[model samples]
Target: MDELLIRLRNPHERERAFSDMVKKYQQSVYYFVRRMVVDHDDANDVAQNVFIKAWKGLDGFRGDAQLSTWLYRIAHNESVSFIQREQRIAGISLDRIAHELPSTLRADKHYSGDEIQMKLQTAIALLPEKQKAVFIMKYYDDKTYDEMSAITGTSVGALKASYHHAVKKIEQFLRGEE
Candidate 1:
């Protein structure tokens, strides 16, 4: 991590640092964004934007928060922006959209792993944006409520409530309950 900081400090070393950063975090970022947008192309675009934003902002990064937290915040904000823009343009709610699983996971072979993951993703997709954000940060990112509050600028209680509601909604969705 110190090596990454050092590499990040030197403009000459920025490329290598950025490359290493992407290699280390890309899958996590992609999965995070994918969970939000569901569409591969949109997730890809937003994930790219998240990295580009991080790269441009790297020089100003003050290390106040863990780098992963900062990156997650960026990714989260970018996803929200994408959703809002889509909503404004199309009058469609992101939460109402169906989850878009990878083609391999949607195959007729019906891998139990894929089926369960898809169901979970679909349930997540049905959550309200803030609740979904809290759920993903807590469950998927393994962030503490305090850390999530800091990243999201919400109180811990509110974050907890959101997560709880999100879980209930997901459980209901999974159970085929409206």
Candidate 2:
């Protein structure tokens, strides 16, 4: 990691290093965005924005966090921004979007989930951006609260509470209690 950072910081190696970093993190970043945005094109655009931000911010990076964490943080911010923009433009909340996810999922060629998976996704989509990010990082990525804290800049205790609430909400949604 240190070697990669050094290479990234070196002017001569910067471009190549950034490209390598993108290659290493792109898929994970895309999937993270995809889960948040629920669409391939939006995920691709947001993921591209994340990498662009990382590249532009590379000189200021202090290496206080792991590259992956930094990238995830960028991804999280971009995803939230994209969703918020979508909500504003469409004049629809994520909860309303969740209600439409079934048909959206059905039409998405990239989505291959079954009925239960769709239900889970819809439930997740209903969460506020931060809670949804916490849930995805914990439940899907199996990220530790500490790791999530670093990525989200949230306190571990708060993240835990958010995760707990997110779980309860998902359970309720799945049980048709939402």
Candidate 3:
């Protein structure tokens, strides 16, 4: 990480460093975005935006947080912003968005999930936005609370409660018990 940071901070190595950074982080970044947006095309666009933003802003980056944490923060903000923009432009309700996900996931050529995985995705889609973020970062990404707090700007206590509630809700959803 320190080596990557040094490369990123060097003008001569900046482009190569960014390429290396993308190679290292792109899959994780895309998966993180996909978990948030649940649509392959949308996630692809947003993930691209994240990398572009990172490239543009890397020179100004101070070494406060780990690079992965910084990237996650960008991805999170971009995901929420995209959702909000979609809601405004299309007037799509959250329920409608969630309702549309299964069909999209099914139609996506990239998707290869089994029935259980599909069901789990459906349950995840049903979560409220913040809870969904908390659930994805914790359950899928396995990020610690402090890491999530850095990414989400939520307090650690709130993130813990959110994750607890998110897990219970997901359990209830998967069990067909509302």
Candidate 4:
């Protein structure tokens, strides 16, 4: 258990500790959500929700995992839940949303990626949600399989497989094969 975790668990010190934690983690959390959700505003809302959940759930956090791993798990859940809820409310299928992302990316002023980067993001957006998360965690975040498993509640073997499939799909998409 780290000092921050200890402080977070301590009711007396929790508020200050959580503030510190947020400052340390907010950008990473926001970017993580941003990669998944695409839109800046949507990612910001989801990131806030992630922190809100973290604040409410901090006391129940056991010291079995690192605080970052725990936070990533929360972030993964919140991002996936946000995507699912948006899909339902918009009455759009995952495939539809995925297809729509390229145009959306083109119009997003906040997205400053180059042409190649935009193409890469479009390929990533075409992935299934779990595979997309796996790809982002490994490629962008560089999380180890153990860390990814802790964050995603997935077996290491499955994570490896998912990463492999996501890579293949991205390759195919980039090559204009599918």
Q: lDDT (CA) for every model shown?
A: 0.80, 0.93, 0.88, 0.89
Indicate which candidate wins on TM-score: 2
State residue 139's C-alpha deviation in candidate 2, in Å.
Answer: 0.8
Ten consecutive residues with minimal summed lDDT in candidate 1?
A: 102-111
Worst 10 residues of 3 by lDDT: 93-102
The alpha-carbon lDDT assigned to residue 94 of candidate 2 equals 64
Per residue, candidate 2 scores C-alpha lDDT tens digits across 1-178 of: 5788889989999999999999999999998999999899998899999999999999889998999999999999999999988899999876688889999999999999999999999999889999999999998899999999999999999999999999999999899987
Native-structure RMSD, model 4: 1.2
Which scores greater on TM-score, model 2 or model 3? 2
Give a tens-digit lDDT track for model 3, residues 1-178.
4799989998899889899999999999999999888778999999999999998888777979999999999999998888778778999877786677678778889898876788788888777778888899999989999999999999999999999998998888778898
Backbone steric clashes in candidate 1, count: 0
How close to the true structure is residue 124 of candidate 4, measured as C-alpha lDDT?
A: 83
lDDT of 1 at 79: 90
Model 4 lDDT tens row, 36-64: 99999999999999999999887688879
**lDDT at position 61, candidate 3:** 79
Q: How do all models score by TM-score?
A: 0.82, 0.97, 0.93, 0.95
Pairs of residues at least 3 apart in sequence or in different chains that clash in candidate 3: none
Using lDDT, give the best candidate's number: 2
In model 1, state the lDDT of residue 151: 78
Give the 10-residue window scoring lowest on summed lDDT in candidate 2.
92-101
